[model samples]
Target: MYYPGQEAQLRAAMAESEAFRQQIEANHARGPAEPSAAPAGSTADSSSGASGGVQTQECPRCHGSGQCNGCEGTGHKDVTDAVSGQMGEKKYSSEMCRTCGGSGKCQLCGGKGRTLPIW
Candidate 1:
């Protein structure tokens, strides 16, 4: 805990990291979610393996990058594990992101950078 003279440096790094985390969260909250289904007569893009061309518009979530916002393109995330009943809940660790399967891609797009539609 005692860096002798690196206190300022450490604090600055921590602040920067927190700011970055906040930015990622804010960006994630500002996007248009993918639609559930197509308009009825639409068809899926078999060639692209997309949702039969049901997408009405680009997903605001990843801007069509299909990258997962949770891991920020890192394909990994930090998580907490429960060790025991009461105290177990306090335990924590980092692991591969289940959302993107360590691929850092969006769930809806499946790393294809797009979404599917249904009728």
Candidate 2:
């Protein structure tokens, strides 16, 4: 099934991209920093199973939104079967997201969108 507020989500996503662009620009304005500025034992990569000194890290599996990537949080998947109908016909249907079991959440994070520090 189509999730409610998809249009709103799209708008929000656009706004978020704008905000992210602004953030990048702001970071650029700060200019370059010394390599030693970063603390030891910390890393910039968030998806490397390391928390980089933070108490918790955003779940890499869902990108911190707690949404199922397989279905984009709609909890449904549109499937087309090529040989399910009359000659050369295709059948289309929607089904629950197998990755999330219809709950629309990331299996790794359990809808919290965060995980304990791996470091």
Candidate 3:
């Protein structure tokens, strides 16, 4: 059940989640934030400050690619079904990935390939 650096990775992920939650709470307490005006002559884009002043990061779960992890981007995966009354017996079947719903997108990022701090 243990892998190298798994504990550290889990702790880091937990800390990141906690920090994100706190940021959301603080933003909510301060009321709706006004979007800052983009600099003159600057191109408006999603990666720019024009994105409502909210910063986005590559999705940690999908690494910003939006590829389905469960099915390895194939939109299908092999599933093992347990047989009733048969010890250690199993049935193998290939089916659509529940995580991505057969769309071959990251479940966590909702296929955006990136994640915003917004709730």
Candidate 4:
């Protein structure tokens, strides 16, 4: 038989653990919902191949802005570069482009500035 107090403590601990698990699951399910507009050098599209592959556009997460704060409109936080070890301002601007958001696209042709015949 278990002690009365011991059972209560165990139950409380289990409840706390479950709550934490749910929080983590919820976080993982939600992801950034924007396009990143950082320079091409800072990003890459590995899935895109020669013939056919996933098209890589700006990171919607950053909205092409490289700072993390949505209010600030930047996709990165203010921190020293790991490699350079230098202090610098990292941020993204929303003034990029209303249409392509700085990607320079008509959306109809994926920024090609031209549309193909739908034949």
Per-model TM against the reference: 0.36, 0.42, 0.42, 0.26
Model 2 gets an lDDT of 0.69
| Candidate 1: Cα lDDT at 112 | 66
Clashing pairs in 3: none
Q: How many backbone collisions does model 1 have?
A: 9
Candidate 3 segments whose C-alpha is farther than 4 A from its true place: 1-53, 79-94
* Residue-level lDDT tens digits of model 1 in 26-115: 755653354443454333445644332223435457766778987767777854454444643432235787877787778776666545
Best by lDDT: 2
Backbone clashes for every candidate come to 9, 0, 0, 19
Residues 1-119, candidate 4: write the lDDT tens digits: 56776988888989999999998677546632333633342333344452322234443444444433323322222333556654473443435544344444334444332222222
User: Candidate 3 on 3-118: residue-level lDDT in tens?
Assistant: 88699888898899999999977875774343353332222235543323445657778876789888767787645555476665544346777878888789887877767544
lDDT of 1: 0.62
Overall lDDT per candidate, in order of appearance:
0.62, 0.69, 0.66, 0.44
What is the lDDT for 1 in model 1? 67
Give the clashing residue pairs of candidate 2, or none.
Answer: none
Better of 2 and 3 by lDDT: 2
Candidate 2 lDDT by residue in tens digits, 30-117 = 6446546644433354555533323456777897899888876777874656565665443324678788888888899888787665
